[model samples]
Target: MFGIRPSQKVLLLWSTPVDAEELQAMVGELKSVVGAEGKVAVENVEMLADSSHAGSHFDLILAGVLPPFQFENSLNVLGEALRILKPGGSLIVRTTDSATTQSTLKLTGFTSVSQPEDASLTDEQKRDIISPVSEITCLKPNFEVGSSMKLSFAKAPAKPSANTWNINLTDDDVDLEDPDDLLTEEDLIRPDPTTLKVCGTTGKRKACKNCSCGLKEELDAEDEKRVEENKKNFKSSCGNCYLGDAFRCASCPYMGMPAFKPGEKVKLAESTLQDTS
Candidate 1:
């Protein structure tokens, strides 16, 4: 007997047409067990196999009853039943071929496929119908199809030890030298501005067009000093000059130069030092 509980949804699958009276009687019996809060539906095996039923709709399904039944496409019928049954739903099948039915149920992805011992029936009920019935029961898996859960297989992270080194120690806790203390006596001395003068011939701050008083060399030396000073004080605005010309800005002074570490001094090639333009 199928366990038709109250408030449960059930499907009755038949392979062949039965007498209207017998069909109604079977449905009535099922309805009585399910009560008013429950539902009961009937369909032919062939139709059930082809019809589109909502997924996880039924709590139980009973096949091959009310009339002697045999599956035409056992796989498709069982598969459709599995598809529409709720997670952990039960399926009870009565077939003439028990071995094939059990095998087909397992192949259709039903779990716990088994044949139960024949149930004792009343004399009046046994006399009403006569057939060699093989009863097989199975259940849909407990978890719904396409559902997933994350699993952590790795061990938990270890806690830090109490004796771990303290990086937050105050500056006074360590013997550290001041940055200014690292400077030498020469670094402290400032250069006199008067020494950066042009040749006295022109009495101007620029070189003469044609000069024989060593004005050009003096001007060149001053230019070189200014270039050195600029190099020493240079700070990257884009912060990508150290990554090479590809990463440098259009106005970057380090364009066309090879990649170098930050704070590194860059030297121009001798060819580049010459005025080609």
Candidate 2:
């Protein structure tokens, strides 16, 4: 309000009903602060009706369309509102997702979202969500000191691999249409798929969190309930490597780190470097 130019009017479009008296007082306060006569208009809004009427060239459109618990257009709805805003103007939408900003830009057809992600957020709701800006840039204990340090990750990182990297066309390497042997996770020490098993709800519960094993899934079958119940103690690995998190791909960074084994962390200091002479 203090910074309002003599020429411009502030338009308030909100989904909730505003207190007219308070709004009038706020406008009055703004006018008094600015020492200029200006206009302020307030409108109540529902998203699906008259979405286009909200703004034509709004310098700023602050939006807060609560997301549906079921999949809905909350992200894209806000983005559409953002599209009507003037360049260098803003369409601020408060949301809980870490990817909200990127989603906002992408949905509105922007190539990139700004860094220090929290800067784009509204100051009021900023406290509640993951401020990727601050959290991503916070001081690190092992960082180089007495100098500025920066990190930029490529959108695509190279797929890490095991065994030898060969450009050569050998029999071992694929020579397509010639003698060749395809290297598989089988060549690596892949755990046996047969050794791994999963239990459905009909199966004796192995605690929840098992993926649907399409092979043995027969929860709908009336005759198989007993069989499934008996199989609940089942164990399984991601069939070979291409399907699930498995031991073979434990070394593959794409597969990610293995689950921490019990007691391994407690004994870490003793397991590492020995007291050498």
Candidate 3:
């Protein structure tokens, strides 16, 4: 799920054991994917191979990489290698057609890289490349590698059920009984557009680009408050700038500038919060 460049590093891991020749080929192409200028490292390990035992640092990590049946623990292994990856580095994993992982990776810090389009490939082939390998896009938030207990284990923590927490930071009907208790979309409803305070930040509010939970409502509330303060401070600065309700009436942090073109006004880019200072 990442673009390999001449300056990047690629790591390939094999679980359930692997042959030497296949390992060699993987190493070769991985190094040569972008003009044979990048570094390639190969390792063959068993279950939980990404632990300290694997003893390798990688940038772009590939795991559970066998074909046909593909890799079983690709998700787990890729996570293991991710510990060593640079902030902007990537991990391209291969798994069966039934893998599912949480978008938490994006929330915490991980970006999926898309493959470049090729005219020679058929539409079906393209679709296959983009399809999620597990449970038809079923995924869960990954906490940490090596520490993940199997689902069969009684000690394994239960994950969030689907829609139990809406990523959109919205509620249909909130119970006033428990202000601290987390509510679900079904629990809350929109009384009206204005009454709803259609904020972009708060509990579990995430945008399209980032899955940062609860940030939207919190940020929106803070910004709304701040915008009010700014308006009061510069109530008559209409000549310098025009800010109607900075939080509700204008472009949201999620809804960025119509054009990303930089300007001299020092406006925050899309998906960014204003400097409260």
lDDT by residue for model 2 (49-152), tens: 35464433444433332211111225555444444444445433333343544454555544324442333434543464442332111111222223364557
Question: Which candidate, 1 or 2, has the higher lDDT?
Answer: 1
Clashes (backbone N, CA, C under 3 Å), per candidate, total 0, 6, 24
lDDT of 1 by residue, 123-191 (tens): 654575566656778999998877887777867888889998869888788988799999999999888
Where in model 2 is the C-alpha error above 4 Å?
Answer: 1-6, 16-39, 45-55, 64-76, 110-112, 115-277
TM-score of each: 0.51, 0.29, 0.33
Give the poorly placed runs of model 3, Cα more than 4 Å off: 17-19, 34-37, 45-57, 72-78, 97-277
For TM-score, the strongest prediction is 1
Q: Model 3 RMSD to the real structure?
A: 31.8
- Sorted by lDDT (best first), the order is 1, 3, 2
- Give the per-residue Cα lDDT of candidate 1 at 155: 70
* Every candidate's CA RMSD: 21.4, 29.0, 31.8
**Which residues of candidate 1, in runs, are more than 4 Å off?**
119-131, 152-277
lDDT of 3 by residue, 1-277 (tens): 2356676667666765455675676577666674555677666645345345433345566654543214544445545555666545555544433314334234334555333222233344345455334211112224433455557645767888886965553466543567646788767875654344333554232343463545456666887898766643432223322332343233333233343222234354433555455
Cα lDDT computed for each candidate against the true fold: 0.78, 0.41, 0.48
